[model samples]
Target chain A: MTLILEYPNTQLKECLIEELQLQCTSWRFAVEANNLSPWNRIPEECANYIKDYMTGKGYQFDLDRVSNEAEIYARSVELKGDGKDAWIFDVDETLLSNLPYYAEHGHGLEIFDCMKFDEWVENGIAPAIKSSLKLYEEVLSLGFKVILLTGRSERHRNITTYNLIKVGFHDWDKLILRNPEDLKKTATLYKSQKRDEMIEEGYRILGNSGDQWSDLLGSSISDRSFKLPNPMYYIP
Target chain B: MTLILEYPNTQLKECLIEELQLQCTSWRFAVEANNLSPWNRIPEECANYIKDYMTGKGYQFDLDRVSNEAEIYARSVELKGDGKDAWIFDVDETLLSNLPYYAEHGHGLEIFDCMKFDEWVENGIAPAIKSSLKLYEEVLSLGFKVILLTGRSERHRNITTYNLIKVGFHDWDKLILRNPEDLKKTATLYKSQKRDEMIEEGYRILGNSGDQWSDLLGSSISDRSFKLPNPMYYIP
Candidate 1:
């Protein structure tokens, strides 16, 4: 079955914008107002509008039927450590927003300009997704390990790692990247191979978080995998 | 991009059968003959005949390619135990011949013909692949691990395990079978999961010998996977 994401129409978008102004208490309102709340109290018009918006963009927010329990469990195992699962997170579109870059221009295939992307990373510019960043810090405070696995080649690893540190993802176990030659294969395979090697070295991967499937599928060792929302369109 | 297996024809098959008779000094004729002489040395008529026979029977005697180095390394790791990566072989069509049963009776899809299949698995019925069996024994003598993984359900595990012992695959560290509930997934995944679990439990999967992809693919933890020629076809 094809799963479809739904979003509100222009009218509902306007209403939500108004609601945002009314509930301007904190950044939490922005998140809560973004259709994450229970739909019981939500007006039909807003719900329909949100559904239409999501469907148009091909984003299926709800994945109830996708029973990836086995895959999830496998991912979680890779993250678990010291009796607590440690997570390695990818920043851009995983924990941070590339939206500023997208918004400054437009939303489409042409949105990603490599030079601009590099500049953003070099400048340590992207802002973290507050909700997920909060979750990341919570996991860290609770003594879970957090590492970063990225596709930004080694050339960009330093800047990317620094950006993560600037944004408060501290004490990372490792920051991994694709070996230049191995880029010929899918990034998922490369990451998975590295994760498997880590497993061989005696690390029980308890959990992994990423915005793309490649970040999760390659690890032969992870137990649980959590995918954060990515409104921006980078899938590599 | 399509990798096809090419086989020798019928006349060449008859000639090879005759050659087999003449070269039957040891069970090593298959490997030795294929390695020692070029196919071009055979008469044109004989070559064409063998090619036709092989192609007609869907046999690609010499076309299989091993292209992935990562896969090779993984296989090697699975097989190389500190003298523990002996040979964990599967039974039906792997070590013993099952053609007689299929030839005399009908195929496996008709119904539950337990008696017929059971008689085939019963002791002293089928002969081992002499050359491969010799290799297995040689590896065993070197003091490696030997563990069998099979698609046979747990209910039949006892009987299947016993049959292997009777047929001379002695001294196994473990005999694993498909749990009844896990039957829904492909045998390859089942075997792979079991093998991974074993690897996690500290047993290095050195080598796996199987007649089907399911058997070979299951143990991603293994170092090397060897496929034995299966004259008979019964893979589940």
Candidate 2:
């Protein structure tokens, strides 16, 4: 779906655009927002521009900003933290960069070639997004359990595990992927349900980080949500 | 969003799976049918398979099947037909085949590259889906006012009109594109609103055919709605 700012007032549209530009979910919500017009798709150039930033310092700044906020939240909750306090991280984009795969493909702008992407994942060569890696290391050091949750099918569990370890993400408290039972679940629902399980286990979720809003905006969510820059693709 | 059949009973799951295998929205509704699960992303292979069928005899059969139903309904309603009776046709996939464009891309399985698609559309090389063209001729001859409704942005009107004419769809009473004012509507909402306008203008919609369910499911709808098979992409 596309989102276009169609307000009569150029100033207001610009303002909303600025705000919505910050996150993919924000744009989605804005498109559905009563005040805004319906959107069909993101502009290709804009999507490509985001990809350019992804490998640049500006994109790194965005990640660093999100990771920094996560750090602050993690610290705030640290004093009261028990071993059960958890920080959730989404697998794709949040923790790992698929730039290599998307580089040949049109980032998230092109129709997703699942076979090609899965092959890339199976290669277990996706490196960690530097800032997220830093956050990952910090969260673990601060005594919060790291839970890696992804919408990936369970069939990729082995490769996903290998990729995570290969990229220096080690000893996560739990790694959750879509099992057969979750076939009918939306990423948001599946994620929320999984978080509820963690909550039921008495784990306090302190912070969450993901590229998509679905990963951060559901039931039993963490105290703070940190969204990194990702305009290439969106998870509904 | 993805849809998976995940009922506890293997038989029920299989049954649902079989049904959902037919369309994207089926899986969407099934997921939320009993408040079952939240889903994200369509299956890549299933989407591709649907694309395969679209160019094959299976797709033709589906079109012929829908056309036959339309013809039957039209014949039954022929006695009541008048100059004021209407039949609505959604443009893309309803009357035109985007196979050439999607073939180069990944059908709807890939992220929609609107720029490339629009360029393709501007080429106006999209061939008419033969069955739909036949249905169009049959309906017009039966004394119904034909209304062409599409979710394409209004700016594409010039190319759209040219394409429709070049593809041999002649003399539609009205050709409606999403105007600037319709920027906030869902496809269903936009089409329904247009139908309401037509109703206000004293038109009685007798029949409707579209690949997506949204084209036929909304308000002020026709007496009979015939759906053509399309599982490539979904419009929300």
Q: What's the TM-score of chain A alone for every prediction?
A: 0.62, 0.80
> What lDDT does candidate 1 reach at residue B23?
28
Q: Write the per-residue lDDT of candidate 1 for residues B1-236, one digit (tens) a residue.
A: 12222234656777867554322211111211111111112323333332332233222221121112112333334344454453466766666655556545332223436576765665445655444455556556556666777766677766676656566777667777778788787776787787777767766666666655457643453445555433223343
Model 1 TM-score (B-chain only): 0.57
Task: Give each prediction's root-mean-square deviation over alpha carbons.
Answer: 23.8, 21.8
Off by over 4 Å in 2: A1-236, B1-41, B79-82
Question: Which ten residues in a row are the worst by lDDT in model 1 chain B?
Answer: B31-40
lDDT of 2 by residue, B132-180 (tens): 9998998888888899999888888888888888988987999999888
**How many clashes in each candidate?**
66, 17
Give DockQ: model 1: 0.01
* Winning model by TM-score: 2
